[model samples]
Target chain A: MAIDLNGAIAAIGAGVAIAGGAMGTGMAQSGIGSAGIGLIAEKPNQIGIALLFLVLPETLVIFGFVIAILVMLAGGLI
Target chain B: MLRTERMQKVRLLCLKKDRRAVVHELHRLGAIDLRRSGLQLSDGSVGDEVQQISDMLIRVGGAIDVLRAYTDVKRRSQPTPVKHMALGTLLERLGSYSQIGETYQISAALKELDDQAEILGAAARVANALAGIDIDMASLRSDVLSFKAFEMSADQVERLKSTIGERGISAEVLASRMNGKEFGVLVAYDKKASIDDVIKGIAPRELDITMKELHGKPKEAAARIARELAENAKRRKELQARLRNLAAENLDKLLALREMLEIELEKGNASSEFKVTESAMVIEGWVPRKRTEELESRLALATSGRFEMEYIEAGEDELAPTLVNRPSFLKPFDYLMEFLSLPRSDEIDPTWIFIISFPIFYGLMISDVGYGLASLLLSWYITRITDPDGLMYNTAKIWELGAMSAVVFGVITNEYFGFQVTQLIGFQGIDWTKSITSILAITVLFGIVQVGLGIIFGIVNARRERENKLVVSRSASLVTLVSGTLAIAGGFFGLMPAGPSIDMAVLAVAALLVTIIFGGREATEVTNLITHPLSYSRIMGFGMASIIIASLIDKAFTPNWAAGPLLFIGFLIIFIALHFLNMILSIFEGIVQAVRLNFVEFFTKFYKGGGIKFRPFGYRRVYTVDADASDA
Candidate 1:
């Protein structure tokens, strides 16, 4: 199928959005997961709470995914 | 809709003889929290008792530690639930252990095992050292005919070489090349030639490694060490077996003793917090007002009318502990709030509010039945594997409830892990392309409502606190938030004629003027008009993100229809892995972001949380029951 210029641009935009979000979430979760493991080592009882805090920052990427999908869908690129 | 439980300050005074009984009764009732009195009452009698209890605690803890080590011989040490026994039952159980004098016996066994471990460890080290020497000896004896070995310094080797050279004794030195500590020389001199100078120059001490001695001594030592190691290992196994047997037989007794000692230690430590006089002990504590009567009755019955309790009205300056009483469904969310901050005594408990909003946001974020089912299963598994009293247990329960909510929401939305499940059954799911405008509008509208509610709550709180300026500013901000939203909506959507837009603008400006004129004390207060509404967009943002990711996963897994089995299997694995990861990310994002919105956006309006949670002095039992609680 012959894709239009706007469609290709929208697809790239979605990709960039998702990638940026993933990068941010990865950076945040790396620090949180490391510290959380150390905390779990000291107080094994804190595993659930530690895990919760460790994953809290992942919302950023999900938000990015949502925006990316919306942009693509709106631009008829999906 | 939200109210913190009332707390009453109480002073419990009893005779020194009734102190233990009174404390035990209070523990059974679980009403009062023993707090140190503000006034300094110089009494040191309880200090000695505390120290004695502490020492006993160490002994009991050490014994349990050893018991735990041996009992888990087959598997890893998992979390064991605490046991609870009635005081009478505990005392009765104590009699049996005391009669047999197992305490001393157990301690002795522990000591013997520790000593055996130490000896076994030393023997292992010696064996290792001997093994190293054996390797060196094998290398040394490989060519004894060509060269003779000497343990000497480098300086001695040099001097010996020179002295031998002067006597016309041609010799080649063969040193232990690894460290140059051991020296060797291959001599090619006449047997009659006098080599007294060489011997004098190198006054080497004997490593005693004559080729024969090297074989015989190492053999003797290795055999002795092997025997000793076998004996120690056998003894260690036997001791371990004995411990395991004892642990199996007397586990109940040991656990009971530990619990009893812990209770005694609590009582002993609590006594120190009490202000004791010559005749009586005065303990000050906070109790829930609703339970004050029950506590009073229990204390009377337990002490036989010998104690006096004076309930004091807590003053404004006093920091009373917060007691939150909520319905069972909302209790788990209360734990969520407590994880962050306990509400102050006078503040509204925001747990109910949290319960109302958190799950909704979480469900909205994930919005997929398959992911929700997975979450429910994962949480259920966590609950099953962990002890019921474990910290993760309640968290798992909370997740289970949230997952159920997500499942319900997902069903209504007709999505299952980004697959339009309803479409397979000839039903239409939500079309983002068609409804994007409405969704965004609704999202922004929800933001306006939440922020408006916050301002209204701020007004109520300010009014309650008798801050007139804050009340006026908050009220004005409420109007400003609403009118400003309307103004933007009307202008952007052409929802009304130009006249309504003018009216909305006028209303917004008028509210701002009121804020500036009447409530100018804090310039910062005006900023919430912009920040608060903007903050609520996160709810929509997070929700959209979840849907987008779910759809992406679905799109990514569109398998080739004509592919072979291996390719199909490969795609299947990738499909499961991708979707599984997306589910986890969505669940975490859903809960955390949802809670964060409420905590940051809603709570900042009315909730000022920083209070001590009511921790009544009692053993919160898990895996053990105090049978006497129902009776007393």
Candidate 2:
């Protein structure tokens, strides 16, 4: 079977988008998780609010995943 | 539903004799939050009384701690039934217990045992030293004994043995033990030779004679030490068992006494904060408006008409503590809202908005019937078993409602644990996959509605505060947001003709300009109005992710008979574990994103919170019971 160069390039682009998004989320959660632990230590009841704040940046990666899925689906790359 | 309870400032004047009873009744009623007068009292009598009460409180507190350690009922055992007593009955019981003098005796016994343990520790150390000696000590106690016990370096012991041999004095090594470079030696030397000369010639600098006198042989002495140790151990056991028995018998009494002493301590501290004179006292505090009458009646009954109380209006400069008053159903959401912030007294509380929208977003994000039912059952079981008023109970109720919402949405989406249940049953539910565009449109519409609600709430809040500019700008911003969204959608999809879209675009731009110039925040307000609705794309994004992951897990676990029984079982285990993990992540992500949209996106518009929570001066009966409630 012959490989489609354009589709492979598009797949690599999708991979880069996901990697950048995952890095962004990880960087954000690092700061948020530490601050969240400090907050929980001071006020044990803030767990829910702390968790909400900690996961706010997680949407960046989820969006990337959705975009990648859409690209793959559109291109029939599977 | 978003309002706070009204509060009133109260000042009370009572005779010095009635101060205790009035304060006691006030605490019992738990209506007022007493503020310290901050004026130093020069009266020595009140200070001395406070010190006395504090000391008694500490003693009783220490006794309770020792009892708790011994019995461990509060620490290790489940809660048991406790008798409820009125204040009078409690005092009567305390009086009877005091007459028996058992609490004091128990405390004294505990202290005595501690001292005895210390002494026993020292004796054990001495016994250890004696056990290292191997000589028959009875022979050393004879009238003509010539042996000397020496603890010295091994080199010194060698030198002494050589010198005694050369001097023609009979000496014999009885026992010797080495510790590093030092030696403990029991030596029998000639009685004629000068023992002082032998010690002075030996390792005099490194010598320590631990055993000076002996009443019996080494073996006999060791046996005696063992017997003493056993007696000490027996005594310690008896004391511990006695304390445990007392705790078991008088646990309720101990709990009540501790509470009573704590109450007295509080009264003493409050008295110190009072503005006191020779015959009268003045106390200031805040009470709920509805409870003022009840407090007045209680005070009258307690002081027998010897008190005068006055109500003062809270001034603009004064910040009254906010106590939110909502219906019972919304009370569970209070924990979540308060975790973010307590709403300011003058502003609207946004907890009701959260209660309405949070579950909808959560349901949409998860969108799986099987997972929803599982979550519902788990939360229900937890809520059933735990204390109803606790934090876990409230949180479980929130999750229970979220799961029920998910179930409803799952039925609409035709998904059950990632499988197309509607298709399996030969029916059609809303196929999210086939109608992705329509789903996207609906999610955008949901965003528009939420943003619209935010602007409306902002307008209403501004109107309440009589801020005309905010009301106008917020309303204009809403118009711009809605029209801009519709115009963009229409132009993108060719839903409308070119002429109308142009007109709609022109109208949107004009409203945006007005919102920017008049809203007083050019960049923030304009960008927020434009991008806020787009932020709701995450709703669709997260819902898609949940479905994708669930389907992936489901696809991985499709049964294949060719893999044989062991492989199939392995796959089954992996399927359960992976699906369980995915379900947890889904729930966590769903709840977080859903609440974040409301909290960060919606709340910023209308809610401004910095208010202090209202905490009344009272103690709840956690371990003890109030006979008044029991009677009612």
Candidate 3:
């Protein structure tokens, strides 16, 4: 139930990494999502391509998740 | 199965009299994609014929629309059997359907009736509004007095009456409740007075009724309008009944005529692409190489040896259309390929790779027995209800396959709605609680294999295109990707001896140099060799997220059986609903991420898809048959 200073800082760093990556992903996807809706409205068959574009930014969050895992391992928390 | 069907360019020269027969035969075969001939020839006659058929098509289309609006014509539950006939015979049959003219007249009459009903409906509304006045409508239109009808709130009418009285205007004001809060006020004043300004200041909505047209009292006029509206409705019904009967008798014939006319129009338009002389015409098209002999025999039979046919090799500069034939089960993946882009005729088709990896990715993302079973049932239901030829049905099949894979993984992981199912049966399967590191390692390794395969495919494609530089560069990329991955694993993770790790790192550096020397601008993508494989870490990330979330839901919402029945039942319902929501999210994320990994990450390495789809000339007939028995 208690944590050392180093452990607490590692956890905070992991949270920041994930939060920053998620915010960046969301920002990038907003423009792509709106433009993709317009494209799909004009050409419904392009739904697959629109979806692909909309999800392309998700790798940012995935990378953040990997970093968080590494941080937890270094702090002996996982 | 990895490559597209080969194609050959075909040129056919025929006598002018036999041109129609040859074109008709080609249409029935439905194997060739017609192209414009190189010779410059006038197509005035063919253009005229195309215009004629197009006009007929428009008329037929209009009639079908009219019939559909009037009646709920039953769609055929089963596809209609095709009727075999020559083009001339089909044209004659279309001409014999006399109901076409009757339908046109009926459509015009219906349109007129609609316009009349609209006008009458508006007049009826006005008459009903004025019915409470109990005054002769014609008398309200006196030339010697200023008459006006205003609709306002009852309180506003009271204010207007008092204000007009205060203004010392000798006028008669009549008020009647129209509906709800609305009061109709009619004011008549001396024509010479300036009382119009007083009424306009009230800001009431003025009604525009032609008083001169209503000769009788307002109530009488309302009755008359209602009667006229009824009469119009009756006439519309009778006309609609006649239309329904006509539709019942001729709807199928009209539909067949429309199809035939469309086909004829396309054939006529194709003639514009042919080279025509005074007594001969030439047609050029692309045909699948395997079907060339069939095309030759069919043309020979159709023209009785009057046509001369020759095959030419497609030039290297020309891009031929891509055509790939797969079994029925693999057809759904083809839809995915088409949605992205078709592979070039000479490049490898990556659909087979997707078929192998997409389901694996999906299974890993949503590995749970209960969720997999639910997805399988949902997909099966969608497939049953959707059209077989439509995109929805194909996508459902893809989901069905992914669900099966999910079930297999779910068994291996011993998960059922996040519960350890094997624990109840006195055995233990793979405990995800202890296998996170192993799973992450496996996912990263899978990424390495896929990326390596992609680079190898790129090498094969470059070699096929005789791009020697691309071949060597891509080979170097594969070597670098493999050796660099091993070096990282051994050096950083201590998976092997330090000596081998150092040696692998050296090999990786040497491969990187080769890549830079031959890869041109592509060498700048060296960092992607590390990051792209690391991207596969997402599979583990999402899979663990799903499991953790499901477990949390179960922990939080599980009902206390020891509580009273009512509270326990309430909590149980909430528990079921949350689990259902989690399952749906899992399905959605599973499909999007699985397809994204394949299309965006795996495909970018080698696939440069700008290939034209092979669209053979001719309609897929539902009501008409191929006249040539051999082609059929």
- Report the Cα interface RMSD of each model, rounded to 1 decimal: 4.2, 2.4, 0.7
Tens digit per residue, CA lDDT, model 3, B268-314: 77787788889998888888899999989999998999988898766
Local accuracy of candidate 2 as per-residue lDDT tens digits, B1-632: 65677788888888998876887787778888886544464331355655655665566666667777777553433333344334445445655565225656766776786776566555444333335676666567556556566556767878887777777677776434544665556666666656567668775342223344234655466466567667767877887787787778766566666676566556666775578778888887888889999999889988988999998766667767777777776677886667668877667777877888888888988888988998899889988888777877887788888999999999888888888876477767876666666776677678788888888888888998898888878878888987787688779778878888888888889888778777886326677775556567677777877787888888988556699988888888888887788889888777778878887778777778877777777776555555654554
Compare the candidates by lDDT and give the number of the best one: 3
- Per model, state how many residue pairs clash: 3, 0, 0
* Candidate 3: pairs in clash: none
Taking chain B only, the TM-score of every model is 0.77, 0.75, 0.91
Off by over 4 Å in 1: A1-78, B15-17, B39-44, B72-227, B327-330, B384-396, B494-501, B518-522, B622-624
TM-score of chain A of each: 0.94, 0.88, 0.97
- TM-score on B-chain, cand. 3: 0.91
Off by over 4 Å in 3: A1-13, A30-47, B40-45, B82-96, B150-153, B177-184, B192-205, B211-213, B377-394, B423-427, B489-501, B564-577, B623-632
Judged by DockQ cut-offs, the docking class of candidate 1 is incorrect
lDDT of 3 at A6: 81
TM-score of 1: 0.74
